[model samples]
Target: MGQGDAPERTRRALAAAFDPVFYRTVYDDIARTGSDPLRHYAGTGWREGRDPAPWFSAAAYLSRYPEAAGGDPFLHYLDRGWRQGCEPAPSAHRERFLERIGARPHAVGAGPQAAPRAPDADLPAGLGRKAARELAATGFDAAYYLSAWPDVAAAGQDPLDHFLQTGWREGRDPSPDFSAADYLEVNPDVAAAGVNPFLHWLAAGRAEGRPLRFELGFRGRIVARLTPLEERVAAAAR
Candidate 1:
């Protein structure tokens, strides 16, 4: 490779790892301008600590591997970071994604492990419309949903629609304490049935006392917490 080919090589590598739809959707300023997501990212996004996809958190990557600074995180990872066993998204599905990248190191930027997990953001709505609508009428928090998955907001799809259609199955969490992935992981029946996890919770999990996420559980209900609890239920609960 000639020195002149470096820029093109870099672009190709970044393009393989970068996700334009995720970029435009997650970041409001970019979405508002409707600029080419890749151009913006290559030009300024990485410098500003912007992530390429849900599986890759730029800020986290830089923090974890400060040596990756002054260049694109994806390039560093694809070139040698993965070989060094560098982590991408610490908060996302780290294990599964790690397996994916390790298995297909050359295809780092092709797509997230979304089909085995990611629904193509461009595909027409198919499965989750009704579940989404039903979820909408419930105490579904739109603000929280957007904050949790800014990509959803960027994609221009309704929050519930995305959740029911893609979010739940993809393991996108609906709230701070509720994990869509965990709910599905613990319940293969629900996963196989292809029912929305949150909807399943509302319809049956709540009655069945299904746990949400690993960290989302109540830790044996501390005695001090009882002071704030409703007295009527506290006595029996304790």
Candidate 2:
């Protein structure tokens, strides 16, 4: 194949190995931490018989965003060397598995949290904007954190504190407030807190046309929706 064709071929190969269902199973397994879902799923697949090379190669894709992949079930399979295509010795799987286990976090939820309280009407609107923008710019992965809330609460610190600690001004424009609307960007776990400043802001953002992404776990496949914030507000206002 020509050099140009090589890129397309490589992309296709990668796509085939990184199946969404497989990743979903992996994420679920990790969330459960060797729970029955993983055990039952593993029993159905010929994972052991497959070459460790592909699994490991796929894991490189997963490990690219370790935290994101932490929610999947294939992590164990990834550890077993089921990568995309990095050639490895047959015996290397055991060593890699041990290393992954040793380094993995005890739980993805434990971390420092910013401790800002609620946002009264007196608080400046600019504050929320500045904080959210900064959080977004600083590799904060706010969407993902919002999705995994409570479960991933400590990861982004207190969402309210996260909003208050920024440098925003309360201009006449009234910067948007966060709400349950924005929390839906990552997952529904965030809705656990009921109503908070972050949820309030998210609701406002939606009202003003900024929608959050909603990801659903369907039998291990991740399907997302750009849920209009307005819809969330209308629903809540009812």
Best by TM-score: 1
**lDDT of candidate 1 over 70-182, digit per residue (tens):** 88876787666775768677424334433433422345567656455334322222425455466544757777999878888998889867776667667776766666677
Model 2: per-residue Cα lDDT over 1-238, one tens digit each: 7877865754444333333323333344434655343344335432433222212432443445444343332433333223332232322343343334342233456568734656644232444555554533443344544454443355646543444443122111112333334343222222322233343344344455433432213212312343468988999999
How much is 154 displaced in model 2, in angstroms? 38
Residue 181 lDDT (model 1): 77
lDDT value for candidate 1? Answer: 0.65
Return model 1's CA RMSD, one decimal.
Answer: 20.3
Give each model a TM-score.
0.39, 0.19
RMSD of 2: 17.7
Clashes of each: 6, 38
- For residue 212, what is the lDDT in candidate 1? 67
